[model samples]
Target: MQNDTPLYQLDPTNRFTHRTQDYDAYRPTYPSAAIDAILEDITPQTVADIGAGTGISSRLLADRNLKVWAVEPNAAMRATGSKQPNITAWEGTAEQTGLADNSMDLVTSFQAFHWFKHNDALPELQRILKPNGRLAVVWNNRDRTDEFTKRYGQVLQSVSSKPVGLGRLSDATPIRQTNPYFTNLREISIPHQQALTLEALIGLANSRSYTPQQGAAKDLLHHRLAELHRAFANNAGIAYLQYQANIFLADPA
Candidate 1:
């Protein structure tokens, strides 16, 4: 059955409320090398992680001893992400952060920027940044070149209305020097992979916002995923999912 609910109607802020646990558990982390490369050059001391879903990106910044403000709209995600050390959770979104002016050294959205209203979000992001502060947007795009990943994507796409993959956010970022919002968008792709068992793979599928949440479609999706695992798993039953952690760094124009 096709889900008649449009993608825009999914309430981008609250859609993941029920799926937070799976998102925290199975969603791949930004590669440490990618993190290192992002932070090595500028050395931002105060950071605001926008759309900080379960603090996946927040914790990485906080771990480096940087003060990170996790800005999230959903209560559940904010509450969970707040418990992390060195993170201050705020109830806000990309378009309206409610933070004071010139308050941050860096503003980042990890695997989350695509969900924002860029026309509205850019100014708010710029308002919070100190002069010369940078904004980093990262996405671990699913690599379909690998056979197992292709089959895994097929399983998700079968039941999805909008499909489970990055849209135009896959390759290009909206931020650029010519744009009114930001200047000099620098992009890089870092190869990454995740090894998981059957259950972890199920959790991975469950974590996606567009994938089936429950009901017959959800069951069928999981069943097909398990079948894919059985068919594609290596001798040790490890299914490898490939990704390219695309990092885009820019400063407000």
Candidate 2:
């Protein structure tokens, strides 16, 4: 997601260090239905998941019995994800994965593509993907049509310095516009939802890079979110955050 924090204010790589726990604890996982849409009839033996925060999507791929290379630049996140069996977690960025050319049958970036310098990352992805290999970019976009969901967007925007992009329902317009090295762009959406407790809801807010972490903004965000939880949370102390898992699949052009 684009941030208003200019090149000077943004730490870029180190932003997620303190957020590792919240990310691992509260971040949602991609649906199996979305994964199936990306894989289709193909059977990939090796999959490289770039910008794999906490290995959420990587674990999903590994659970399908595929060898997963969980490439993440953050040491803290990589450490958390490495504990998962069948995942080779390591430090890597989308712009420079350092994987062998034509080595991977499939490459994916889940909720991380927007953070990458696509001009460089696309070529790098294209280089690593084998002939006819697929590249998938996926996001769990919040259902903003719901009243609570709309309120959540307002909360995020109120706190965020710039326009928040990840949770918004995407039509793949940005992906289609930015993709120069890939062709046959295909998109699929799978209905999904997550049950978040008050604490988890706060954790979800903290998990975002753009969310203010300290000072008055932080206090205000928390106060407003607590209010939201009070009004929208179910009897079980949970709020169902609806989402549509949007998957964009393409091949090297």
Candidate 3:
């Protein structure tokens, strides 16, 4: 069944304002294989990670010894991300990253591209990227193939008054259509998983802005999640949220 109710309006300036702590704590990182594939042929000296919530993607790029500009609009998220070494956490959005024209050799956004207003952001991203720059958009899509994962989806959907469109990676039609500024689209998927206890799973849910985090809804969500965990947790009393790190790479046209 489709949820036709609109999700609560997001704050234009601080979409993840209240969810930063949970986001930093529970959001899974991109797979190393995905990272390796993104950096496969090119040696980039400078990279810009737009919508870099809590620096998860920025730190990954920094680990490769590249200078990274972790551009994020949310104050709380940017502050937490700034503490990481080799990262210059800038208070900026994908549409207005405060960087010189043609300043970056590569531009990346992990689990962030969908949030962007494609028309405005594409030009801004193109402005900052060098002639040879590549744009990579990535997301860790939850694998709902197994019973546990399907049940977990039910937990979130039960609490979500608005439909959560989490399957964006599988359909590249919109991303491909919106941005004529890019060409030679390439896609890759890397299998991944994250182990979580029941509490952590709740934390993961809280990290999503669309989910209800207060009132009876919050109570109901957590209760169902605990029940789900009890029914499906493995021998070690842990649940594995499987994912496929989907990456879409293209050259600036």
Candidate 4:
């Protein structure tokens, strides 16, 4: 999906280190079913995860016995992935992956494709993927229809509406239209939930690329979060945060 305003332009060097701790703490791991679905028709002997932050998705693929190359441009993220023996973390971007041509059986991006310069990255992906290889993109987005999720989303918008940019729903159709490499693009909507205390919710928000870390904005964020906690707290004092995992899968034509 094409957005008039970009969400966040991260500095490649500082991006991973600055957010590493929070990212490792708060980022949701992909469901095993999603991974299985992605690998169903195509048996990927070797896979490359572009923008593989902290190896969340890479680890999932690796668990399926796929040799995973966790390709991340950010140094700190690569460092984090290096600790995992299953994944070989490489420092690379989607546009210029250092891996040899036609070496990858699958090229995947999880919540990271939006960061890529598509014009440049598309050809790179095409080059790396073997014939009829799969290209899958997955995003876990808030299920704003639920009351708790709606309130949490409102708090996020109140904090930084500018950075959130246009809604993901609006962009999906256009993305399908513009990208010609994928012939049979299909979406799999998976229902998911995260049980969180107020503190955990705040940590999740803080891990986002657009969230402000300090000063008046940070104070405001905390204040709003407090209100959100008070408003959404349940009998057990924990909120059930609902999410929808929207996965788009296609083959490189």
lDDT of 4 at 137: 86
Query: lDDT of each prediction vs. the true structure?
Result: 0.84, 0.83, 0.83, 0.77
Q: How accurate is candidate 3 locally (lDDT)?
A: 0.83
lDDT tens digits by residue: candidate 2, 1-253? 5444332234556778889888988888878898889889799999999989888899899988899999998888888744556789967888899899999999998987767766677889999999889999998888889888789878988987854444333445545875667888888889988888989999999988779989999999999999998999989899978888989998887
* Angstrom error at residue 215, model 3: 1.8
Candidate 4 — which residues are off by over 4 angstroms? 1-3, 6-16, 164-175, 178-180
- What does the lDDT come to for candidate 4? 0.77
Q: Would you estimate the TM-scores of all the predictions?
A: 0.92, 0.90, 0.92, 0.89
Off by over 4 Å in 2: 1-10, 162-180
Tens digits of per-residue lDDT, candidate 3, 1-253, equal 6443322223434767888989988999888899899999999999999989899899999999999999988888887643656799888888889899999999998987766766678888989999899998898888889778778887888788964555543555545775667888889989988988988998998988778979999999889989988887889889888898999998888
Clash count of each predicted structure: 1, 0, 0, 0
lDDT (Cα, tens digit) per residue for candidate 1, span 156-248 = 888877663345445344575356768878888899999999999999999888898879999999899999999988999898999999998
Residue pairs clashing, model 2: none
Comparing 2 with 4 on TM-score, the higher-scoring candidate is 2
**Model 3 residue 241 lDDT?**
86
